[model samples]
Target: MNSISSRTFWVSLAVAFGVTLYVTSSVLAPFLIGVAIAYMLDPLCERLDRIGVPRWAAAGAVLFGFFSTLTAVSYFLIPFVWGQLVDLVKHLPEIRTALMSYLQPALDAGKPHISPMVIERVQEIANISTGTIVSGANKIVKGAVTGGLAVMDVSVIFVLSPIVGFYLLKDWPELSSFITDSLPRAYEKKILALARAIDQTLAAWLRGQMVLCLVLACFYMVALTLSGLKFSLLIGLLTGLCAFIPFVGFAIGLTAALVAAAFSFDTWTGWACVGFIFAIGQMLESYVLTPRLIGQSVGLHEVWVMFALMAGGAVLGFTGVLLAVPTAAILRVLLKSAYGSYLESDYYTK
Candidate 1:
């Protein structure tokens, strides 16, 4: 094939493959998650192997350590989160009353002609109760019925992941060699350079973001609790995790904290303290945590990040959002390199 024909063929094939993957994404979710886990663990496994551990032994050790850590976190954190959610649900009525009391004056002052219908709708939504005990009991029963199947699925992935990861990691070098050897002779070097650049960018993003989330979560919990906020741990951990979704963490965390402050303490002093706590947290995150951990060089603007997240969510639900930023970053680097090459070419200069 001529260069143009070859490029067209490859692009068409890529589009077809992407469409096929999208169509089958639900079934592939577990495998995708497993691959991500494997990717993260591969480095640790390699380090162990370099220190004289056998590949199988290293993989086993890494998997065991991963599960053990997960179990410990679940044991401690799950209950705390669950309790907070339960309490929050239980207090919904009171919270609604407090919210109305807080907002009634503002609404009256801002819009004298506000319809009662609108106010009623808002009040109805706010008064929505989760009825924790009854709801919890029903959920438990439903969960028990569904849990068996979920467990089976988890077990299958758990079993398959390490095996797949082991072979993938073990054959990683050979796989790279095979791919490089098979590439078109003319494009081989350029393709390899692009691949390496994409890999490094993704690795930095995934690993760095994970560490940042943990650090932020710890900081949020300590700061909020010291400020005497209710459900500090739950709210903090949630906020940190949601930080992955751009501005979502700040919005949710601040809103929750503000409401809790409104309810828990009646004094303006209490409210001011809550506001100051979040302001301090934001400042620390901006000035210290993010800079120290992830740095500003991920090369994505906040607006672009938000757009990619929304686009991804629209296309592929949660998985798309998860994959979007790294994918965008990699594509951005490739495009920049390609554009630079074009700029240096005779056709572009002319």
Candidate 2:
């Protein structure tokens, strides 16, 4: 094909893929999750295969290990986390009352600085907000309906994702070979280089982040539990999961720990301990965990990562969030390559 025709064909293909993704995003979540799982486990499967295990057997073993971990979490961790969640929900009113007690004084003090008429108008609005309340109730009802459907979706994913991962892992080698063979001869070297770059960036980030998250979760769980905080496990798990969002996880986790400390202990000693634990965790993450693990392999700036996360979430919800980092990594590689090419081109040289 002529260069123009080739470029047009590629651009059209890209547009088609984008449209397909947009249309199927809702159903793609589980498959994407499975792809991630399979991607991570592919190396292990390969290692096993090299050691004389059949590819299918190696994939089966990995899947077995994955399920075992899930089963363990379901049995031991879920119950404790669920119990804490229920207790937290039950005491939310009390927590709110406690918060209001502290906040009310500040609000009251500020009220005197504002116009009396403004205060009166606000009070009147608050009193006549029944329609707002009804509207909120309707939203709650709608959310509940959405949640019911989400639960069904979750059920499907829970069953399907592992199976998807298993098959993907099993056939990964064949798939890779097929794809590599299908690439155009002239562009094969460039495409392979980009693919390898993507693989390195993605694999390093995902594996390192997983390890980092697990370590942080254990640390938080133990430290908070030792400090005698209520709902420690749940809070720790939340923090660990949110670790993907950079500083947000620590901020949220620290806030919860402080609240729990304040609620559970009257003295400043518990608060000090809580603060100390979090400070130490931060130090470990900053100085030890991140550098040793994720480092610069992600190849996206902190700001870029944050933007990618927000944009992904806004566009694709949870699935978008899951895809964001990898997408960003790939984009970074592509952008760098394109910029390098541009710098060498006649347009730049001129």
Candidate 3:
């Protein structure tokens, strides 16, 4: 129909999709995870199809191989990580005690600037916060009976996500064709251009982040384990995996690593070694890996990414958080296009 009506229809359609995501948030986790897997694997499947492999076989082979590797890694790594986690939980009191011993001087030094009540409350909390943290962690994992993630069932993610990914991968060509055919004829070129921009930005981010995560994980795991730290893999790998989130991931991972180091070592030399390792990680990520892999051309500033994630999490819960990056990237492209159009219009020239 008319431009105004078409715009209204698309906007309304977007809002409805968002509402549907929220309503089906529980189921959305596995489906979204599956969709993400499928999206990432689509390129490989396409390549296989072009090389004389049947599409169904290609999808099946890729899915099977990917999941097989994942399952194998999990099978071995999970037990070790779980064991470390158990030991770490058991020693939380000692870790807390050791932590407070180091921080007690800082707490005392802050007495003049900080209120006595606040300092006193902090010490009180420090005395028992470990148990609270452990309890909370326990509750979260206990919720795993449902089969997904926190609030969603954790176990279901393993079974459901891959299944969803497999089918999506198999039908991806048809899906892409359907979507392309449905675009409004008048605006199809513009829409396709926007889609391509978003695709490039998103693909760069997803692939780069995956590489960054793995590289960082390997670095941390090897370095920390070499230095004799406990749960090095869990800490390192998690830090690396979450590295896509910017500072928060590294900070959280570093904090845990430091705590574990503190508990594991007697001297400041050991702590210094651990600190050095992470410092190197931060420098490596900021200076080396990120620029080489993701680059600055994508317009994904750390601040914007963080803001999008936080806003998404606030507005739509976990599903929002999962979608935040791609959605923000798409919006960024659209906003850029809109701005260009606005600059070219008579309103700007007048």
Error of 3 at 21 (Å): 2.0
Error of 3 at 237 (Å): 2.1
Compare the candidates by TM-score and give the number of the best one: 3
Off by over 4 Å in 1: 110-167
lDDT of 2 by residue, 1-350 (tens): 99999999999999998889888888898899899989988888999999999999999999899889979877988879877876766665566555545555655776969887876675566435533544554565456447877678888998889989999999998999999999999999999999999888878877988998889998999888988888899888888877767788899899888767756777789889989998999899889998899886567676788899999999988878888998998998899899999999999999
Q: For residues 1-350, what per-residue lDDT tens digits would candidate 1 score against the true structure?
A: 98899999999989998998798765665566656777788889779888998876787788778878988988998888778766776665676678778876776665557787876766556445423433564566457447998778777777776667666666555777899899989888888888877777677767777887787788888888888888888788988887766677888888888878877887898888878877877787778877776677766666777788899889998668767886788777888898999999998999
Q: What are the lDDT scores of the predictions, listed in order?
A: 0.76, 0.83, 0.87
Clash pairs, candidate 1, are none
Clashing pairs in 3: 146-153, 147-153, 147-154, 147-155, 147-156, 148-153, 148-154
Instruction: Please provide TM-scores, in order, for all candidate models, with all chains considered together.
Output: 0.84, 0.88, 0.91
Look at candidate 2 and give me any clashing residue pairs.
none
lDDT of 2 at 263: 66
Error of 3 at 109 (Å): 5.9
What order do you get sorting by lDDT, best first?
3, 2, 1
RMSD of 1: 3.8
Model 2 root-mean-square deviation: 3.7
Better model by TM-score, 1 or 3? Answer: 3
